[model samples]
Target: MTQSPAIPLPPPAERRRLREAQSLTQAQVAERVGVGRDTVRAWEAGRTTPRGRKAQTYASLLAAASATAHEVTLRQADPTAPLTPLTPAQAFDALYAFCAPALVRQAYLLTGRRELARESVERAFQLAWHRWPEVAVDPDPAGWVRATVYECALSPWHRFRARHRHPEAPPADPADRALLAVLLRLPPPYRRTLLLYDGVGLGLPETAAETEASTPATANRLLHAREAVAARLPDLADPALLSRRLAEVAAHERLRAARPPVVRAGSERRARNWTHAAIAFTVALIGATTFTLHTAPTQYNPPVAPGATVQGVPPRAAPGALSRAELDLRTKLQRAATNGPERLTPDAR
Candidate 1:
């Protein structure tokens, strides 16, 4: 057998320059660039350089890291003290404060009515705040919150049950309202997938992880969501509305991204405990219903007891004469009949 020729590598100086420009340790650079530590070492030692897509990825990482490092340095040099880390409650409050405007914008885009959006965002944030710890730890906390807000915005439950639910038709903002209308019409899975991908800017893998779906499933959901949205666009009065709405949505995202970190308070802790109690109560109710359904005895009326006529008079058997097997068979037959004819075999006749 013949051995293949060895591949030539990049010079050591080039690799060192890239690393220095990014202001990253070899390991840090490797992680950000999605390369192994050994690959970094090889590049630095003039042993090898990544080729094709890998090389492009490395270049992108170098550029991004350089930009991020500059930003961090600038922030640190400011005279203001760094923001304190928030307690869970404080975090929830901060989240609420941030979500209020954000949700309104999202809702407005979705429903074309500021009032409806405002109500939806408020309710969503309140519920989210109660479960902040779980939501905050999510990979994309903002996206998770936004998804919840969307659900609240279009919830049929509230529309049906709440007397105070928005009764008047939502005022339409041509651009956003169109998108919202399209999104609302989509199936839940498709809607969620679209929001995660386009609205939240998550890639397929990230969306799959967040939704607990396979990559293909997430991709299909996104595709279907877009199709659904596109099919309804003609119904929108203004064709130019989508572009205007997108710009507004982008602005909103930037504003939220720029907010300062917040700290938590004692009262927030108590509220969280109350939220937990509510969740426990709901679970308990569901469990009780399930138990009742499982354990309750089924009632079946047996066919009228057969009577023997002796000299044109009806006669009854002695009282309490049914055998266990007879009682069981009778119940089985009743059940079989109630279920369907398919349950009865030819031999059952």
Candidate 2:
């Protein structure tokens, strides 16, 4: 097969400036290019150059961005010139169209589930659509979406979810089934490394960075994974042959990605739903707070304690009962005291 067309790139410094001028992040560029953010950073830093298909894609993106900027400049210079810029939806659709089909196929290779592959691809694109501002000028929008797809397709969490609890039917072809089984046997990290390096045609450094491993470690994983594959399928011993076989396996699957408009509309609908939910939650919280404020007690009324005797004070003694002599004098006074003051008074002290 003929190689993709490659073009001369500007000096590394200028290349970075061109991307920066477009307000594109290194991470976005890397995502589109199917490499790690750090790989793009390395490209900008002049530590490396993009190669093969990735190089061609990178060049095309830069050139297109540069051309657009020039168009904008010319429009600004001559206000009457009709200005055209890619709308977010249009840009998103382009990105989805370019990446979705291949992503679905790749995802199937990873999960060996056609439905899951399609779902993962759609989910990834949905996320990209949600973060269009970031994805729009991303140097590698495809890569960004691809990473999400890979994560979604290979997530262990999916196994626990109801829909994905049981394993899907294996491929009809024994060889395809066996290959998938073997791929699944390898650890996720090793499997991912092999796919990116061999199947996806990523450079060693790019693969290592994307996999979040050091170059040496990535190399080790690749070696071990390849060794396992070669030991199992001796005929596909060569790396190129192995890569080709992987492609063949992926191509054999008839998975179809959701259409661009459907994906875009779904993304919008999902975002809208989330926004409405958030607003509802906020309103509920505000209402609850208001209700509490209005219904709460207005003043503090201290509780009254039961009465108790005074501490440290003695009780007064009760008077003795009236004596007999006092009673006799009281009787006499009652009978004689009406007319005489002397009679009312007692004679004895």
Clashes by residue pair, model 2:
28-139, 29-139, 29-140, 31-140, 31-143, 31-144, 32-140, 32-141, 32-142, 33-140
Cα-lDDT of candidate 1: 0.56
Residue-pair clash count for candidate 2: 10
lDDT winner: 2
The digit string of per-residue lDDT tens for model 1 on 247-303 reads 344333222321222212323565778889999999999999999999987997688
Q: Write the per-residue lDDT of candidate 2 for residues 64-179, one digit (tens) a residue.
A: 66656665676789899678876677667655654566677788878878998899888888898888889877766666777888888888888788978788998888887888
The TM-score measured for candidate 2 stands at 0.65
What global local distance difference test value does model 2 have? 0.78
What lDDT score belongs to each candidate, Candidate 1 first? Answer: 0.56, 0.78
**Stretch of 10 with least lDDT, candidate 1:** 1-10
- Runs of candidate 1 exceeding 4 Å displacement: 1-90, 108-116, 132-140, 162-178, 232-244, 247-349
- Looking at candidate 2, the ten consecutive residues that score lowest on lDDT are 1-10
Alpha-carbon error at 46 in model 2, in Å? 30
